[model samples]
Target: MFLVTGATGNVGAEPVRGPDAPVPDGARPVLGGLDDPGTLAGARDAGVRHVVLVSGGSAALADMSDPISRSLTLSERAVRDSGMAWTLLRPRAFMSNAPRWAPRLRAGDTVRVPFPDAPAACVDPRDVAAVAARSLVGRDPRGRVHELTGPHPRDQLAVLAEMLGRDLRCVGLTDGQARAEMERTLPAEYVDAIVRPDVQEVTGRPPRTFRQWAPAHAGAFR
Candidate 1:
């Protein structure tokens, strides 16, 4: 039995779940920032040998200054020290995150961004899952940190320009404005996590690109 962190994270299911959604079949999930003794004990009870932890962004920020990073770091430490085999996956910028732009895209060709110029490489969640699967069943992926992302780092505007395939308007926001709009719901560490560069060398294959991802998910914007 496997203790998948999220239905959509390392487990690789594709669906946007609100906080209230059921776990759906075949999923045993452990959310971050909570005590995991029960969950880990359950995994142990289930005879789970390998654990795949989907840590967001590239850095664990283990220093734990903030609640979000601290929680993730704590969870990773618990799993690593659990005497069970574990693989830590850190991926930057999921293309699925682009749905945050959906309302703006639906309203007009204009999109607003906090860091339109900051470098970010959109990662495909499916690829992240593949790596996790390899870690679980293929070989010993223990004691390894997989930093995953697309082939090239791109700014928000560039990604949208490529995905939209036509002229698009982009509006830049002040940090204050951006924080109010986006960070309101997101955790502080998540909103502030440093964007790590793409490390395609780990998988021995190129990371998936926005162009490749947009078509399948384009319906969200429309």
Candidate 2:
């Protein structure tokens, strides 16, 4: 059997379970997180053979001092030492996260957001899941770091305008202003984590576009 940890979207895990917590018993586990001893111990005790980590795909590019990147680095190290087959997925930003702007889009003709001009090869979650599945099924996908990305790239302004089919406007926010607004609820590191980089291709098939994803979930905008 296969167990997927931090089974949310493209995200990280904060293992808080104490070292004495119940050890997970399974044949295969997609262990996520390196900071928590319980999770690692659980995986080891469970007799797990194959493990996959859902780490920040491109977060490796960040500076070593960056906590997020540092944590991922630690995770990679722990997984390597686990003596189990491991697959690390490094997927870029998720197109699914675009819906975060739905409220602004519905409020007015202009959607106020940060990084208006940045282009992202925002990948579809489906593609990421597919790759994980392939790795989980033991297709000889061990000891590999896969950098997943969208098939193409597009700026938010163009994507929103096209999807809404109106003269939607994009209001860019200054770095400081954006930070202040975001920090009201989110940590500064999370605010800085929002990066968009264009990708040229996908591993297996053509990835979906924001143009495609946005319309399909148009109900969210309304």
Candidate 3:
């Protein structure tokens, strides 16, 4: 049987619930973290032959230099050592990220965000799910790491313009500036991680440009 971890997350949830395809009956959702040894035991008990791990691209265990990084590192190790067939999905920035800009777009045509020029190949959660589904059913998918991304890459301002249906002014700020603005509104680590370039590489496809994603999600901004 196929075991799906991170089943409730953006990509994993779509395969089980999205319109494109339905997960076969009896597929197990392995809830909990990789670092938890119980997760491995549960998979074994469930008769899971194939395991798909939906890991964050930013969570590279080999590069862990901090506590947060170490957590990711340990998780990867657990999954790798689980002795079950495995397909690791490391996804970069998610297209769902656009929602963060919703309020700013709703207020006006202007979008104020940090990392204005940082480009990302933001991926659709649905696509990530599709890939995962394929991996689960394929016999040869084990021991592979698939990095998922959109079909194109673009910056936040470009995405804003598409949503606004006109040229939207962007107020760019340094990391410090962004931290100051978001400190009261969001967790500090969240703001810092959101601006990383690794998000583009994990999502392998040229992300759907903001122009493409905007019209589809216009209602959210409106």
For residues 92-161, write the lDDT of model 2, one tens digit per residue: 6677787787777777787767656556566676566666666777364588777666654667567667
- Cα deviation of 14, candidate 2, in Å: 20
Which 10 residues in a row give candidate 1 its minimum summed lDDT? 10-19
C-alpha-based local distance difference test score of model 3: 0.63
TM-score of 1: 0.72
TM-score on alpha carbons, each prediction: 0.72, 0.69, 0.71
What is the C-alpha local distance difference test score of candidate 1? 0.64
Cα lDDT, model 1, residue 171: 75
Ordering by TM-score: 1, 3, 2
Q: Each model's C-alpha lDDT?
A: 0.64, 0.62, 0.63
Candidate 3 lDDT tens digits, 40-121: 8687677867677776654553555556556666777787888777777776667778888778766877776676665556
| lDDT of model 3 at position 184 | 44
Candidate 3 residue 129 Cα shift, in angstroms, is 1.0
